[model samples]
Structures are given as structure tokens and as C-alpha cells.
Target: KANNTLKEIAEILMASRSVLLFTHINMDGDTLGSSVALCIALRKLGKQAHILIEDDVAAFLRFLDKGYCTYDNHIIENPDICLCIDCGDVDRFRERKEKFFEGKQKGCIDHHVTTEPFADFNFIDPTASATGEIIYELLKELPVEVDKDIASAIFAAITTDTGNFQYSNTTKRTHLIAAELWDYGVDYNEISVELYQNNRLEKLLLQTKILEQITVFAGGEAAICGVTQEMLEETEGRMEETEGMVETLRDISGIELAIFVKEVSREKCKVSMRSKKYINVAEISQKLNGGGHARAAGCTVMKSYEDTKQEMMRLAEEYLKG
Candidate 1:
């Protein structure tokens, strides 16, 4: 549960002279866009802000300020406040946990159901479509100017996480906020081009192979695909290249649920889930010690791909049958 209100969190952020933002391990558009937008706004308020992101950021998101993405060592000095944006679990920012705790005022701004308000101040609103939506409101409280740069970042955050406004999580408020971003001159076309249209040939090849290996289950209501390190090596594709692979399965005519299993290591796998209608993939992810929205969710399992896939399929079968 969150203990602090948005205005309260904004007051703390406004009072702070320096801030450090943490993004999740696998830097996605929501986390990156929210953090970058907040950082940019904070700088406009004459505060020192930096976003500590994993070096493995996807190429598509590089349009955001790369200068802000840095480590504690890279910065001239540590910040007074540390905040994690859109990250539901502390483990997501484990690499920077120490530096995060070192801040005088620790905070979290997110829109995830499982976030527990671990920081000194927190604003976790599962009702919000994305953390970017929360950040957009936070900016109004801080009363910082929203420029084109900030607009685009937040736009990407909301757009990507909401699956370009196609996911069940998107609401009237989401569209209203998006329209406001357009008023602020956010380049929606550019964001779309970078996020969806821009693709590497190797990634396409890798996705083709994964699609060919799809396993259907739940009487064609569900499908699953496994991506191994060998497959990446074989296709000369990076792990990040498989970003939308799960959606491909869900898009099939008869499929209501889709799963993408990425073998992170020999004994560990990262899974993404998407649902068309009835299935609540978030509940499914929670069963695997993960959390997300009703239709889209993800988890990392510390088991072999075969074991993990088997368990996920069993769970999928159970949920579908119920």
C-alpha cells in the first residue's frame, strides 16, 4: 500500500536539490520514459537528477536523453533523493539498491498492483494505465514546465505500456492524457516509428524461428513459445529483440492467451504473458511470483525452460478450464 499522496511526494521532490531515479533491470519504455521525463522536469526546476539504468537499454529508447542514464560512479556526486519509477519490486533495481537506500529521501512512483510502498514516500496507483500517467500528474504538482522533450518521453511511456492504446488497461483518462501530450507537441509518429516499425533483420529472423516453434494449448485458447540462448546465437539476435514476441501469439484468431518464455540462463527463464479477453495473465504471473495487469504480465522463473514451460502450461490449462 502507498502511504504518501501525489502532492506530498511532489513536495519532497521539490525540496530535494538532487535526485537519482532507478529503472527496472530490463529497461522498457514505461520505466525509461517516465524516469527521463521526470529527470528532465526536475532539471528544469534547477535540481540535479540522473537515471540509473542498466547499460543494456533497447536501441529504440535511445531517443530519450542518454546523458541522464548513468551510474552513481559516473555522476559527480550522489543525490539527496532516490526514486524508482514504474518498478513494482525492489528486486527490479537490485543492482542500485545500495545507492538507492543511501539517499536522504527515498521514494517510489509507480502503477503496479504488487508495489508495497517500501520507500519513505510512495505513490503506487494500479488504476493508472502507466507510471507515465502518474508522472504527468506529478509534474503539474511540481509545476514544472512540460516541454516537447518531456512530452515525447511520457508519450512513449504511456503508449508502449498500453500497447499503443490497444490494451485493456487503457482508459478514457489515458486518451485524454495522450491528447494533452499531443498538444504539447509530442512526436507520436516518431515514437511509433522507433518503437514498432524500426526492427533489425536479425530480430525478425529470430522472431520467425520463435513463431515456428509455438506450442498451442488450452484447446487453441493459449499458445507458448520458448526462446533460448542458442536460438539467439543462431539468429545473431539480442535478447531485447524479442520484445513483442508474446503479442504475436495473442494476435492469432483463436488464441486468447499467449506466453513467451526466454531462457535467461540454463536454469532461469523470463516469461511474458498476454490475454485477449477472459484470462487474467496478471493472476497467472502472480502464481509464478510475478505481477502485472489483468491482460499483460511477466515473471522470471529460476528453473529450466522445460520445467517452467510445463508449469506455465499447467497453470494456463487450469485457468482456462476454470
Candidate 2:
């Protein structure tokens, strides 16, 4: 089933002259890496390709966007195709870029289990460890070569999404692909240092604040942590700096479910959930109008911090009981 879709997508890429690729908002390594890698590969195939992102690239990921990324309000004048990568839906695109889909041929390449087909050509595989894996397979079907830049982007994408091949999503194919990417001279050591070891003082201070407020429940089986706007201001931190905070909760010896809630606005809180075993965070996120992998998922609640935390805790308790 997916092979046919990939073939069709390949045909689209082969036929298009210009392509505009989009990543989801609050971009993560997987989405940014996959989009940028695809952009580079498409350009190598002699297509005019550009990557558009709604938010500023996270400091750690700026290396991937040296000259390939564009953040301006200007739109490409009548691009031949618009490819939304790693995004579950068109609504994930920024308001400015939403119109780019209206009169153009649209396609999507994603690896989310709950994603609906929103494009003319939709290729989704929930089993793939990362969207980058899907992009790699598609690149194989095309006539492009995986250069160093492309390999690095894909390596970062798959590595981060699979938690450096430690997450449950990692499979034989994931490792095989990683081996291929390494063979392309992806600078694995540098990438790991930059991604996992290079932490700013502000981020450490923010982590301290989050740790100070960490709560344990369900007899140490569940943990919850949070950060507010004040916490961000106090630590001189931006929201993007909170990327790996939830993992800290999951790493606790007795924790099976971890929740990290951040106050994005006065009346809104973004909740990130992680489960080490048994519990399915995706189902919990779905109940909150969001979706993701079973082990890692998120949702946004339009409520006060306390209210949102209470709601998520309630859901977590219910799911943990199952």
C-alpha cells in the first residue's frame, strides 16, 4: 500500500519544477530534519526547492538551515508543488503559508498514526521510527544521491525521534538506515554532542525550576512537571529550551508515565506526555484533541495552569489504571 503511494509521490517530484516544503510549528528535529533533507535532495535532482518554517529554528538545529531555510513572509510565486513533511494536518502550517496549498498540488509525507489524508498524495507509515525514514525510502525511489548535508539532516531526524536508538520505536530497519547514514559521513559524534550535551546555562536554570516543582503520584509510577511564563522569564529561557525537560521525568527509576506541562499563554498550557511502558500516551493525547506515538504524545489545553495540570493528571490516572 505505502509502496504505491511512494511511487506516486516520486512521480510528482520527478514531474514538478519547483517545490515548497513546510514543517510543523514549534519545529522538532524530526520535522525540520526531514523537511530540510527532502529540500536538499529535491534541489540535487535539479528542482528549485525551498524550506519554509513558521518558527525560528531552535538554536541547536540552526546548523541544518545555513542557506536552505527561509522564514520570510514572501511566498513562492506559484510553485509547482507543496509538500508538507512530518505534519499530521494542513492546520499545522502557519497562517501565512496556509494559502500556499489553496491553488497548488499538495502532498504530505508523515509517520503519525492518527494522521488523516489531507493532501492529494498522502504517504503515512506509523510503523516508521521517524518521518525521515519515510523520506529516505522515497529518496531511494528518486534519482537523487544522499549527500553529506542530506545524510546529516536525516541522521539527526531519525536519531532524535528514536531517542538515539533507545526508544521502543527503533527497529532493525531504523538501525540499518542509521548505519547507511553513518556511512555517508554524518559526523555522528558532533551531532550527538550538539544535540544532547550542549546545554546552555539558561536551560539548566530552567530545568532547576522545573525540578523544584516536580510532583509524583500514582505511587511513584507517574510524574508531572511544569514551567510557567514567570519561570521562563526568571531563567531567561525560551519555550524551545524546554525540549528535553519531559525526558528527565521519564528517566526516574520508578516512573512509567511522565507529563510536562508548559504555560504557552495566560490561558493555555501545552502538555507533553511520555510513557516508559504499558500506558499509551497517544490515546490520552487523542482524548485531549492531540495525537502522537504511544510512548510520546502531546496536547494543548485552553485552561489555567492548575486546571490543565489537574485535567491531565486525571487522564493519566485513568489510563494508568488500565
Candidate closest to the true structure, highest lDDT: 1
The TM-score obtained by model 1 is 0.96
Clash number for candidate 1: 0
- Candidate 2 off by > 4 Å: 1-4
Which run of 10 residues does model 1 get worst, by summed lDDT? Answer: 70-79
Residue runs of model 1 more than 4 Å from their true location after superposition: 73-78
* Whole-model Cα lDDT of every candidate shown, in order: 0.88, 0.86
Taking every candidate in turn, the Cα RMSD to the unseen true structure, in Å, is 1.5, 1.6
Write candidate 2's Cα lDDT for 140-234 as tens digits.
Answer: 98998889989999999999999899999999999999899987888999888878887799898888888998999988899998999999998
Candidate 1 lDDT over 215-289, as tens digits, reads 998888899997999999999999999998899899999899999999999999999999998888889899888
TM-score of each: 0.96, 0.96
